[model samples]
Target: MIDWKRNFLMVALSQFLSIMGFAFAMPFAPYYIQQLGITEPTELKKWVALFTAAAALTLAVASPIWGALGDRYGRRIMLLRANFGGMLVLSLMGLVPDVKTLVILRLVQGALTGTTTAAQTFVSVQSPHNRSGVVLGTLSAAVFSGSMSGAFVGGLVAEWLGYRAAFMCSGVLLLAAGLLVLLGTREEFVRPVEENGSSMEDRARMFWDKIGPATPILALISIMGFVLLFDSAWMPLLVQEINGGIKGAAFWTGSLQAAGGIAGFLAGPIIGRIADRISPPRIGKISAFGAGLMMTVVGLSQGFWQLFAGRFGAVFCAGGLDPVFQIWLTKTTPAQSRGFVFGWAVTARALGWMAAPMASGTVAWMFGLRAVFFISSALFFLLIPIITLIARYLQPAPQPSAPIHAGRR
Candidate 1:
C-alpha cells in the first residue's frame, strides 16, 4: 500500500495555500460590488447574492463531471486543473471593468475551480480505513486555518492596497500552491476498463448498483447542501449589520469570517474523534440541530457580542458535519468508486449553494434579513428527522474486506 500519510500532507498543504488565496478576495464581495458602482444598499445586497449564486450554480453543473473524469483518469489531474484554472480566472477578476464583467468571470470560476472538494476526494481515497476520520478532520482544519488566515490578511490588504490588488495577490498564492501539488503529489491510479459494448448509462447504472445499500447516505449528503445555503448567502451581511458601519467594514467582516474558521479549525477534529468513538450519525444529528439553534440566536441578537457568540457556536457545530459525512462516506463506499461518489455528493452541495444565496437574498428582500436566519434555523430542525431516517436506513452492506454496519445502534 502507498504511504497515505505522505499523500495527506501534500494535499493538505496544497488545500491550505489554495483556499487561503481564494478566501483572500472572497469575503470582500460586498465591498467589491460597491467598487463596481451600484452603491445603493439594496443593489449591493442583491449583487452579493447574485455573484455567490452564479458561481455555485456553475459548480453544481460541473463538479460531477469533473469527479466522473477523476474516477476514470486521476484525481491529481483534477486538482491541477482546478488550481491552474482558478489562478487564471481569479487573477482576471482583478482586471474586470464592470459588475457585469466580474459576474461573468465568477460564473466561469464556478465551472473551473473547487479545490477544496477535489482535495477532499484525493485525501479520502488515499486514507487508511481506521484513520479516515482523523485524516479528514485534519484536512478540514487545514482548510479552515487557511481560510482564517486569508480572511484576516485579505481584509488588511483590501484596506491597504485595494480590492483589485487583493485579487491579484490571491491569484499568485493559488499559483504557488498549484506548483506544490504538481511537484510533490504521487498517485497509483489504475484506470477503469470499459466493457467493449457498454454505454455511459449502463456504466453509471453499474456503478450505482455496486453501492446500492448506501443510497440513503447519498440522500443525506444532498440535504447537507441546502442546509448550508442559508448561511452562505447572509453571513457577510450579518457581520456588516453587527459591526454597524461602512468604515472598516472589510476588517470586521474578515474578523467574523475568521471567527467561523477558528471554530471549525478547533472543533472539527475534536468532533471527528467523537464520531469515531460513538457514531457519526449521532454526531450529525446533534450538530445539525445545534447549528440551527445557533443560527436562530444569531438572528435574534441585538449587539455585536451576541452575534459573535452565536456565530461561533453555530460554526463550531457546523464544522462537525463535513468530517462526519466524509468519514461515513469513506466507510460505506467501495474503494474504486470513491471519486465518483464524492464528486456527485459535491454536486448536491453546489446545488444547495446555488439556491441559497438567491433564496436568502430574495427572502431578506421580501420578509427581512432576520427572517432568513429564522428560516435557516427551522431547516436545521427539520433535518433532525431526516438524519434519524438516515441513521435507520443507510446501512452499509457487508464488504469482503470491511464489515458493514448501521450509523446508529
Candidate 2:
C-alpha cells in the first residue's frame, strides 16, 4: 500500500502554493487596474466586478473538464498542467504593455485555474477513508495559508512597489508552485474497484443520474456557490466599511478575508468528522443557512466589534459548512463518479458565484448594505423551511455498490 500520509502533505503544500500565488493579485488587482490607467474609480469597481464574474463563469465551464481529464490521464499530471499553465499566464501578466491585455489575461487565468479541484482529487484518490477528512482539512489550511500570504503581501507590496512589480511577484510565485508540482508530486491512481472497472465516461453518466436524486447534496453545494458570491462581493465592500480610503485598503481587506480562510482551515476537518456521525445534509441544513444569515448580520453591524462578531460567526459557520459539504458530496456520490460529481459542485458553486457578487454589490450600492443583508437573510431563512420540508419528504439515493459508472461528458 502507498504511504498516503506522506503524499497528502506534498499535495497540500503544492495546493497552498498555487492558491497563495493566485491571491497575490486579488486584493490589489482593482487598484492596480485603476492605477495602470483606468482614470475612474467607479469604472474600476465595475471592471473589478466584471473580472469576478468572468472568473466564476470561466471556472464553471472549465472545472468539469479538468476533473474529467484527471480521471482520464492522472491527477498529478493534470495538476502539473494547471500549475504550469497558470504560471505562464501570471508571468506574462507582468509583461503586458496595456491594461486591456492584463484584463484579458485575468479572465483567461480563471478559466485555466483548478487548484482546489486538483487538491481534492489528490487527497480523495490517495488518502485512505478514515483519514480523508483530516488530510483534506490540512490541505484547506494550506490554501488558507496561501491566501493569507498572497493577500497580505499584495496589500503591502502594491503600496510600496509598482503594480508591475506586484504582478511580477505573483508570476514568480506561481512559477514556483508549478515547479513544486513537477518536482514534488507523483500519481498513484487508485482504481475505484478491483474488478470490471468503469470507464471515465460511465462514471460521468452515473453522476448525472444521481444528480436529480441528490437534491440535498446539490442544494448544499449550490448554497456554497452562493456563499462564494457573498464572499467575493462582501469582501471588497467590507474593507471599505473598515476604512474608506482605497489606498492601503487591499492590505486590510485581504488580511481579514484571509483570516476567514484560516478559521475555515482550522475548523473544516473537526466539523467533517462530526458531520460524518450526524450526516452532512443535516449540518448543511443548519450551517449553510446559518452562514448566510450570520454574514448578512455582519453586513448590518454598525461598529467594528459588531462587524467583527458577525464576521466571526459567519466564518465559524462557513468553516463547519465546507467540510460537511465535501463529506456529503463524497458520501452521497459513488466512488467512480466522485471526482465528476465534485466537478458539478464546483460548477454550481461557480455559477452561484457568478450571480451572488454581481447581484449583491450592484444592489447593495443602490439600496445600502443593511437592506442587502436583510434581503439575503430573508432568502437564507427561507432555505431553513425548504430544507425541513425536503428532510420530511425526500427518499435517500442509493450509494454505489461497487463504484458504479457515470458516462463521459
Candidate 3:
C-alpha cells in the first residue's frame, strides 16, 4: 500500500505555500497599478477590473487543457509547471514598467498557473477513495489558512517595503512550494494505453462521454461560483453598513473577510469526518441549508455581532461543500481519467468564479447591497434540491484499489 498520509502532508504543505504566494501579490494589484501612472479614480477602477477579468478568462480557458495533459503525462509534472510558471511570472511582474505589460503578465500567469487545482489533482489521484473526504477537507483547510495568513503578511510587506517588493517575496514563497513538491512527494501515476490507434477526437469524446453524466456535480460547482461571488462582492459593503460611523472601518472589513477564512480552516476537518460517517451528499444538503439560513440572517442583521455570527456560521457550513463534491467525484471517476475529470471540474468551477462576482456586483450596484445577500440566500436554498441529485450518481468508494503508477507523457 502507498504511504498516503505522507504524500498528503507533503501536498498539503505545498498548497499552503502556493496559496500564500498568490494572496501576497495578487491582493496588491490595484495598488501596484496606481504606481504605474494611472491616477484617475475611474481609470484605476477600469484597469483593475480589466486586469482581473483578463486573468480569470485565461485561467478558465487553460485549466482543462492542462488537466488533459496531466492525464497523459503526470500530475506531479503539472504541479511543478504551475508552481514554476507562477514563480517566474510573478517575479517578473515586479520588473515591468507599464500597466499593459503587467496585464499581459497577468494573463500569462492565469494561463500557466493553477497550483491549488493541480495540487488537488495530485492528492485525489494518489488517495484512497474511502478517505477522500477527510483528505480533501484537510487540503481545503490548508488553503484557507494560507490565504488568511498571506493577506496579513502581504499587507505588512506592502506597507513596509513596497508592492513590487511584495511580488518578489511572493515569488520566493512559490519557489519554496515548488521545491517541497519536487523533492518530497511521490506519485505512482500510470498513463492509459491508447489501444487500436484511437484518434484525438475519439479520445476527447470518450473523456466527456464519461463526465457528461454528472449534471448535479456541474450544478454544484456553478453554485460555488455564486457563493464565492457573493462573499467577495458584498461582504465589505455588509461590514461597512454594520460599522456605520466607526473608526478603522478598513481594519474591520479585513477582519470580517478574514473571519470566513478562519472559520473554513477550523471547520474543514470536522466536516470531513462527519461526511465520512453518513454520506457526502447528506452533509452537502445540510450544509447548503445551513448556508442559506445564515445568508438570510446576514440579510436581516442590524448590528456587527449578528452579521459577524452569520458570516462565520455560513462560511463554516459552506466550507464542507467542496470536500463533499471531491469525495463524490473521486468515487465515481475512474483512476486513469481523474486528472482530466478534475481538470474539467476545476474549469467549470472557475467559470463560476469568473462570472458570479460580475453578475452579483451589478445587482448590488442597481439595487442595494442587502439585495445581493437576499439573492445569494435564495441561490443557496435552491442548491438543496441539486445536492439531493448528487446521491443518485454516487457509488461506493474504491477502498482497496491500487494507486496510479507514474507514466511517461
Predicted model with the maximum TM-score: 1
The alpha-carbon deviation from the true structure for residue 121 of candidate 3, after best TM-score superposition, in angstroms, is 1.4
Per-candidate Cα lDDT values, in order, are: 0.84, 0.68, 0.78
The runs of at least 3 residues in candidate 3 whose Cα sits more than 4 Å from the true structure, single-residue gaps closed, are: 28-49, 93-102, 196-205, 233-254, 296-307, 368-370, 389-409
- TM-score per candidate, in order? 0.92, 0.84, 0.83
Please give the range of 10 consecutive residues that has the lowest summed lDDT in model 2: 188-197
Prediction 1 TM-score vs. true: 0.92
Measured by TM-score, how close is model 3 to the native structure? 0.83
TM-score, model 2 to reference: 0.84
Candidate 3 at residue 300, lDDT?
A: 91
Indicate whether candidate 1 or candidate 3 has the larger TM-score: 1
lDDT of 3 by residue, 27-112 (tens): 66766787798866456545665666666678888988998999988999999999999999999998899999999998899899
Task: Report lDDT (Cα) of residue 59, candidate 3.
Answer: 81
